[model samples]
Target: MPFAGTSPHEDYTAAVERVAGQALGVLMDAGGAVVPAGFAVADLHAAQTRDPDADLPGLRVLGSDALAPHVLRGTPVPSDRAEAAARAFAVFPPDAVGASPDTAWIVTWRDWATARTLTRCGLALDVPAPGDGAQVADATSWQTWSVRMAQLSSLALPGLDGPIHAAAREGAEALSRGLVRSMLRRDYRTAARIARWIAWVAADGVAVPLDLAPLLRHVRVFGGGSTRTVLDTRIAQHVTGLEGS
Candidate 1:
């Protein structure tokens, strides 16, 4: 049963949990790295939640930190995680609703796993756990989030509009990390591919429609940590066509 509470923070915590829980469910089905190996979608859904107890309504205050512990390892929820998470979400409630929250409730739940991570480590250390903040800019933990923001925005892709492009264009001038460099150059052929599925989903109207094998293959060729270079003119052309069409 959802926690019945009076405080806004409690309501928010319950809401975050519901959102993250749903997202995680979808992610589990999609077979993302977010979940532990061998854990099936049903298993995650059925898995009993542990730690952070969910007893304290104040946990909502920690915001992203509140949900970090449940999702990723090595991330501990700080005692102040609740306050930090709350503040983070308060900054952006729209995004606080996980990606496609209405349709991908399971994915949202999986994404909420970050709350566990935040609870374990505390908030001052990492501003936003993965997936907690929609845009990289919302991450107060790392200034480099701006770099990730750039990579997500630019690339001359069609239908992939918004601040991401602007961030990438601007970030290229000011932030020149190796990966950032490749992304700024539209050198996707060599850039590390983090969320090709998300990209595909974002670009295409269908859910997980693309055969991610090729993208993964290219990612392997690019190497996990290699600096990316996005010279996929074909993809660029497609994006251009999308924009023009």
Candidate 2:
């Protein structure tokens, strides 16, 4: 069945899972290099080239700026292009979120991933913290922040000390709470995504209340040639023998 029921929540969860699964396929095919074709780089380029104050409805100009860096990770791109993308990402105005909440959230979400990518490449970015003090007023917002936290924790970069670490732990708590809420609402697809993030965070050595160890093992066995493989490798590389209880 495409979805379990006719509920809107089920429909939404099914859509999100479809997108996530497609992304996984892209990641696997790219071997961790390049974003999926679904991101529409040409559209993003047009948006970025337009005037910031232009009256463009629903256009997320900073989308490519924030995402390109992560997409190019472990891939060969020219230094000038990489620098340009990073520069655009770095100078993204915080107030831009006021223009479009949805677009802004996406930009910020990818900004976090961009930071992780830069760090992985032995580079640094002066980007602002994502969702700092933001309230999770709904499931959508919670999922947005949860995915960002999952990306951040998965990096497990060395010398990552201080307030960022504290913030990650706090985000972990919020994600756990959100996970329970999603499950209670019978949003199993969302719950599964959250569970994957929980496993990712646990693999990164932060203590999460949920024990997805069995699930993780199952993924390792059957999640071959997919994003699950990527996550498993990351966990094995950086986790240092830590696993959820």
Candidate 3:
């Protein structure tokens, strides 16, 4: 009988394909003059199937070398490309975080994703609640704070009981600080992603201190047409409990 869930190879392949497709979509949406390097996908597949230990090399070749720098450096690629790169990094296994200094951003991105997933699934396992005494003094610390905000946002989603509302309320100040920092740096991609969580918090009847309305408005205005549509549709689907409502 077939395995009940995806095999390791299958998971790796799916991740590679998703990232590649998103990267390609970014290039297409931007009408970019330079084509993405083609070898990364093949290299990733080979590494995953032939050598488990080669995953880091494959991720570097594809994400670090090919996609990440362009996104981080704020190169001329479309905003969607940066968003896609960030999303791609979020999907990497936790072990991939320490593979290289160049890939360090993956740690924060993965934590943010985990926070959201955990909240969405309503599982608080090992999640740091408010007043965990976490501090944000450096990049690594800021990543941890991001995770905290993400968890707070998730906990604020409707239907959760207990002290989640109080926890989310306690986290609002920190989340506001993060939002302000992102806006000051003009890192709208980060700002927009964080804003989505804020929106979710408000939807759950918690009052967030920051005014994400204008920031989110700017994000929609600047985001490319197709990308914005896809994201808006997904958010709507999630909120309404309808597949394509």
TM-score, every prediction: 0.25, 0.40, 0.38
Best by lDDT: 2
* Model 2, runs deviating above 4 Å: 1-26, 30-81, 87-92, 99-113, 119-164, 167-174, 184-197, 206-245
Give one digit per residue, the lDDT tens place, for model 3 in 41-97: 333334345644333322322432224223223345444433433444445444554
Q: Which residue ranges in model 1 land beyond 4 Å of their true spot?
A: 1-24, 28-48, 52-161, 167-213, 217-245
Give the 10-residue window scoring lowest on summed lDDT in candidate 2: 53-62
Residue-by-residue lDDT tens digits, candidate 1, 1-245: 23334575545544444333432332233432132222222322332254232323223322332242233223233344345454544454534544473324322322243333343444433233233334534444223553344333222233223343434433332333433445445455333322321332334443333333454445435432211112122222233223223
Query: How does model 3 fare in lDDT?
Result: 0.41
C-alpha root-mean-square deviation, candidate 2? 10.4
TM-score of 2: 0.40
Among residues 3 or more apart in sequence or in different chains, the pairs in candidate 2 whose N, CA or C atoms overlap within 3 Å are none
Model 1 scores worst on lDDT over the 10 consecutive residues at 225-234
Give the number of colliding residue pairs in candidate 3.
Answer: 0
lDDT of 1: 0.35
Q: How displaced is residue 185 in candidate 1, in Å?
A: 17
Put the candidates in lDDT order, highest first: 2, 3, 1
Cα deviation of 144 in candidate 2 (Å)?
A: 13
Alpha-carbon lDDT, every model: 0.35, 0.43, 0.41
Model 3: CA > 4 A from native: 1-92, 99-167, 223-245
